[model samples]
Target: MRTLRFLLQKEFRQILRSRSLLISIILGPVIQLTLLPLAANFEVKKIAVAVVDHDHSTYSNKLIAKIYASKYFSGGTYHSSYEAANKMIEQNKADIILEIPQGFERNLVREGHEEVYVAVNAINGTKAGVGSGYLGAIVADFNQDVRLQWNQPGHFSEAPTIDVVNANWYNPFMSYFLFMVPGLIVSLLTGIGAFSASLNIVKEKEIGTIEQINVTPIKKHHFILGKLIPYWVLSMFVFTIGMLVSRFAYGIVPVGNIGLLYGFLSAYLITLLGAGLLISTYSDTQQQAVSLAFFFVLVFNMISGVFTSIDSMPDWGKALSYLSPMSHFAAVMRMVVLKGSTFHDIQPHFIAIIILGIVFNTWAVLNYRKTT
Candidate 1:
C-alpha cells in the first residue's frame, strides 16, 4: 500500500506538470460532451418533398398543405408532371415525391377509393424511409378526415377501433438526445480510460521513466495499481464534467440512482484501465500503444449497442459483443438512466466487468517483467 501510494504520487505529479497535455486531456472531452449531443441526433427532420398535382382540386390542395405543414417535411413545391417531380429526387433536392392523380377527389367521393402515388429516393435509405412514412401517415389522416366529412351518420357502419396509447416512459417527448447522451458519455469515458491511459504508460517508457520504476523494489501488483490509480481518479473527474454537461447543456438527468451509476462506473473503469495497461505492457512504443488502444476502443464502440441495437445483430456478433466491456457499460448507463434499473437488475453487467477486471489486470501483471 505504501509503495503504491508513492508511485501514484509520482504519476499524478507527472500528469499535472504537463500543462499542454493536461489541458488537451480535460478540455477535449468536455467539448465533445457539450457539442456531440447536438449534432449526433438520430431524429430525421426537414425532409425535402416534391408534389405532382394533376387534380388542382380542393382535397388535393388540402393534402399538399398538410404535407408541407408537418415538422418532418419542407419545400414541397408543386411540379407540372410526375417526370418533373422525379427529376427533383435525382438532383437530391427532394427526398420523396407525392403524386396526386387527376380526378382523385371525384374517384374518392364517388367510388370511395383512389390511389395516390408516392415515390421515395432510396439513395439515402433511412431518410427516404422515414420521410415516406411520415407522408403516408399524413395522407392516411387526411383520408380519415375527408371520409368522415363525406359520409352521413346513417351511411357508415361503425367497427371496433383499437387505439394504441403509446406512453414514452422515461423520455416523454421521445427526444433522441435523451437516449444518445448517456451512450456518448460512456463512449468518451472509455476512450479516455483505455486509449489515453495506455498512451500515458507508453509515454513513460518512451521517456525512460518506466525503466527507473522497474529497477525499484516495488511489487508487480503495486506497480500496476500505481499506474492504474491516478488515471482512475482523473476518470471520475472527467465523468463529473460530462455529467454536468449532460444536465446543464443538454437537459439530461438520469432517472436512476446516481449512487448505483457511480458504483458501476467505478467497476467498469478498473477493467478498462487494466486492459489499457495490458496493451502497454506488450507495446514497445507509444504509437503502437495508441494504435492498439484506438483499434480496440473503436471496435468496442461499434459493437456496444451505442448507435444501434445489439438484439438486431447476428448470433456471432452478439456473442462477440458480450466480450466487450463497453457493451456492458453502455447497457448499464442506458438501463439506469432510461429505465431506472436496480442493482439486482444489473447483476450480469456488474459481474461481467469485475470478472474482466480480474482477467485484464492479471494478464498485465504477469506480462509486466522487472529486469534487474
Candidate 2:
C-alpha cells in the first residue's frame, strides 16, 4: 500500500511536469468538442447549380425562382447553352446543371408532361445524389403547384395522401451537433486514455526509471494500478470538462442519471487505462508506444459506431466491433444522452466493459517483467 501510494505520487508529478502532455490535456477536449461537432456535419447544403433556360416562359421563370429560393441550393447561374452550363460543372463551380428545353412550358401545357435534362457532376457521389434529390423534390412540388393553379376549383378532388407524423423521439430538430457531441466525448476520452497512459511506462523505460522500479520489491499489479489510477482520475476531469462544453456550447444535457453515466465512465476509464498500459508494456520506446497506441485508437474509433451505424454494417463488421471497448462506450453514451436509458438498459455494455477491463489489465500485468 505504501509503495503504491509513493508510485502514484511519482506518476502524478511526472504527468504534471511534462509540458507536452499538459498542453494536450488542457487543449485537446476543448478544441475537439467545440470545433469538431460543427465541422463534421452530415447534412448537405448549398448545392451549386447552373441553369439553361430556353423557353423563357412564366412556368420556367417560376421553376427557376423556386429552385433558387430553396435553402438546399445556391442561386443558379444562367448559361446560354447546355455546353456552356456544363463547363461550370467541369470547373467545379456547379454541382448540378438544369437545362430547360425549348417549348418546355408549351409541351407540358399541351401534352400534360415534359422532360427536362439534368446533368449532375458525379465526382462527389453523395453531394450529387443529395443535390439531385433536392432538385427533383423541388420540381415535383412546382408541378403540383402548376396543376393546382389550373384545376378550376377542385375538379378532380384531392388524391389520397398518407402523412407521416414525425416523432423525432430524442433530437427533434435533428441538430448534427447534438448527435455528434456524445460520440466526440467518447473519442476524446479514448485518446486521453490510449495516448497518455501508453506513453507513461515507455517514457520511464527510455529514461532508465523502469529499470530502478523493476529491481524494487514492487508487485506488478501495484505498478499497474499506480500507473492506471492517476490517469483514470485525470481523464475523468477531462470528461467533466467535455460534458460542460457539451452543455453550454452545444446545449446537450444528459437525459439519464448523471451519476449512472459517471459510474459507467469510471469503469470505462479503467478499461481504457488497461488497454494503454498493455500497449506500454509491449513497447520499448516512446515512439513505438505512440505508433501502436494510435493504430489501436484509430481502429477502435473507426469501429466505435459513432460515424456509422453498427446495425447497418456487414455481419463480420458488426461481430468484430464487439471486441472494441469504444464501440460499447459510444453506444452507451448516446443512449444515456439521447434516450435517457437506465442502468438496466446499459447493463450488457457495462458487463462487456468489465470483462475487457479484466482481460487488458491481466494481459498487461503478465506481459510486464521486473527484469528487462
Candidate 3:
C-alpha cells in the first residue's frame, strides 16, 4: 500500500507537469462534445436540383413551384432540354434532374396519367437517394392535389389508402445530437483513458527513468495499479464534464439513473485502461505506444456502433462487435441514458466489460517484465 501510494503520487505529478497532456485532458472533451454533435449530423438537406420543363404548362409550373418551396431542396435550375440539364449535372451544379415531357399536363387531364423522368447524380449515393426521395414525395403530393382538384368522384373511389403515424421513441423529435452526444462521450473517454495509460510506461522508457524503478523491490502489479488508478480518476472527471456539456449545450438529460451510467463507466474504464497498459507493455517507446493505441482505438470506435447501429450490420460484424469494450459501453450508454434501462437491463454488457478488464489487465501484468 505504501509503495502504491508513492507511485500514484509520482504518476499524478508527472501528468500535471506536462502542459500538452494537461490541456488535452481538460479541453479535448469540451471541444469535441461542443462541436462534434453539431457537425456530425445525418439529416440530408439543401439538395440542388435541375428541372427540364418541356411541358411549360400551369400544372408543371405548379409542380416546380412546390419543389422550390420545400426546405429540403436548394433553388433549382431551369433548362430547355435534357442535354442542358445533363450539363448542369456534369458541372456538379445539381444532384437531381426532373424532366417533364411535352404532353405532361395534357396527358394527365385527358388520360389521367403522365410519365416524368428523374435523373440523379450517383457520385454521392446517400445524397442522391435522399434527394430523389424528397422529390418523389413532392410529386406524389402534387398528384394527390391534382386528383382532388379534378374530383372525378367515381374514378378513384375504390382505391385503398393507408395512413402512417410515426412515433419516434426515446427521441421524440429525432434530434441527431441527442443520439450522437452520448456515443461521443463514450468514445472520447475511451481515447483519453487508453492513450494516457498506454503512454505512461513508454514515456519512462524514452526518458531512461524506467531502469531506475525496475531495479527497486516494487512488484509489477503495484506499479501497474499505480499507473492505472490516476488515469482512471482523470477519465471519470472528463466523463462528468462531457455529461455537463451534453446537458447545457444540447438540452440532453438522461432519462435513466445518472449513478447507473457512472457505475458502468467505472467498469468500462477498467477494460479501456487495461488495454492501454497491455499496449504499453508491448511497446518500448512513446511513438510506438501511440501508434498502437491509435490503431486499436480507431478500430474499437468504428466497430462500436458509435455512428451506425450494430443491429444493422451483417452476422459477422454483429458477432465481432461483442469483442470491443467500446461496443458494450456504447450500448449501455444509450440503454441507460435514452431508454432509462435498469441494472438488469445492462447486466450482460456490464459482465462483458468486467471480463474484458480482467483478461486485458491480466495479460498486461503477465507480460510486463521487471528486468527488461
Candidate 4:
C-alpha cells in the first residue's frame, strides 16, 4: 500500500510537471462539451415554401395564410404557375410547392369538391418527410374546417377523431444536443487518457527508467496501480469539467442520479487507462504507444454507435459493437440522460465494461515486464 501510494504520488507529479499536457487535459473537455452540442441539432424549422395560386381568390389567400402561420414553414414567394414554382425550387429557393387549382372555392362550395396540389422535394429524405407530414396535417385541418362550414357535421359517419399523446422521459424535448454532448465528452476523454497514459509508460521504457524501477523492490501491481491511478484521477477531473459544462453552459441536466453517473464514469476511466497500460506493455516508444492507442480508439469510435443508432444496425454489427468501451458508455449515457435509467436499466452495459476493465487490466499486468 505504501509503495502504491508512493508510485501514485510520483505519477501525479510527473503529469503536473508537463505544462502543455496538463492544459490539454483541462481544456479538451471544454471544447468538446461546448462545440459538439452547439453543432449537433436534429430539429428543423423555417422550411421555405412556394405558393402557386392559380385561383388568385380569397380561398387561395386564406390557404397561404394558414401555411405561413405554421411554425414549420416560411413563405418564399407567390408564383403564377407550377413552372414558376419549379424554377424557384430548382434554384434552391423553396422546399415545398403549394398549387391551388383554378375555381378552388367555387368547386368546394358548388360542386362539393376541390383539389389542391402539394409538391415536396425529396432530395433530403428526412427534411422532406417531416415537411410533407406538416403540410399534410395543415391541409387536412383546412379540409375539416371547410367541411364543417358546409353542413357536413358527421362526414365519416362517426366523428373521425385522432388523439396523440407522446411522453418523452428524461429529456422531454429530446434535445439532440443533450443526447450527443455526453458522448462527445466520453470520446474526447478516451482519446486523451489512452494516448497520454500509454505514452507515459512507453516514454519511461524508451529512456531506461523502467529498468531502474524494475531493479527496485516495487511490486508489479504496485507499479501498475501507481501509474494508472493518477491518470484515472485526472480523467475524473476532466469528466467533472465536462459535467459542469453540460449543466451550466449547455443546459444539459442529467435526469439520473449524479452519483450513478460518476460511478460508471469512474469504471469507464479505468477501462480506458488499463487499455493504455496494455499498449505501453507492448510498445517501447511514446510515439508508437500513442499511434497504437489512437488506432484502437478510432476503431472503437467507428463501431461504438456514438453518432449513429445501434438499434438500426445489423445483428453482426451490433455483436461487434460490444468490443468497444465507447459502445457501452454511449448506451449508458443515453439511458441516464434520456431515460433517467437507474442501475437496473444499465446493468448489462455496466457489467460488460466492468468485465472488460478487469480483463484488460489483467492482460496489462501479465504482459508488462520490467525488462525489454
- Please list the C-alpha lDDT of all candidates, in the order they appear: 0.89, 0.90, 0.92, 0.84
Using lDDT, rank the candidates from best to worst. 3, 2, 1, 4
lDDT of 1 by residue, 25-51 (tens): 689778998888889877889898888
Better of 2 and 4 by lDDT: 2
TM per candidate comes to 0.97, 0.96, 0.96, 0.86
Clashes of 1: 0
- What does candidate 4's lDDT look like per residue over 1-372, in tens digits? 988877877877888999999888898678766887667665667788888888888877877899889888975688888999999889888898988999998998899788889899888877888998998989888887777777655655645678788898676786777778888877888888888878878888888888899999878888888888888888888888988888898787888888888889889888888999999989878888878988998888877887777788898878888877879988888788767899998999899999989998999998887655
Clash statistics: count for each candidate: 0, 0, 0, 0
> After superposition, which runs of candidate 3 have C-alpha atoms over 4 Å from their true positions?
152-156
Q: Give the best candidate by TM-score.
A: 1
**Stretch of 10 with least lDDT, candidate 1:** 152-161
Candidate 3 per-residue lDDT over residues 231-333, each given as its tens digit: 9999999999999999999989999999999999999988899999999989999999999999999988888999888999898888889999999999999
Candidate 1, RMSD to the unseen true structure: 1.4
Instruction: Supply the global lDDT for candidate 3.
Output: 0.92
Kindly list the per-residue Cα lDDT of model 2 for residues 257-335, writing each as its tens digit: 9998999999899999999999999999999999999999998988899988889889888877998999999999999
**RMSD of each predicted structure:** 1.4, 1.6, 1.5, 3.0
Candidate 2 regions exceeding 4 Å error are none
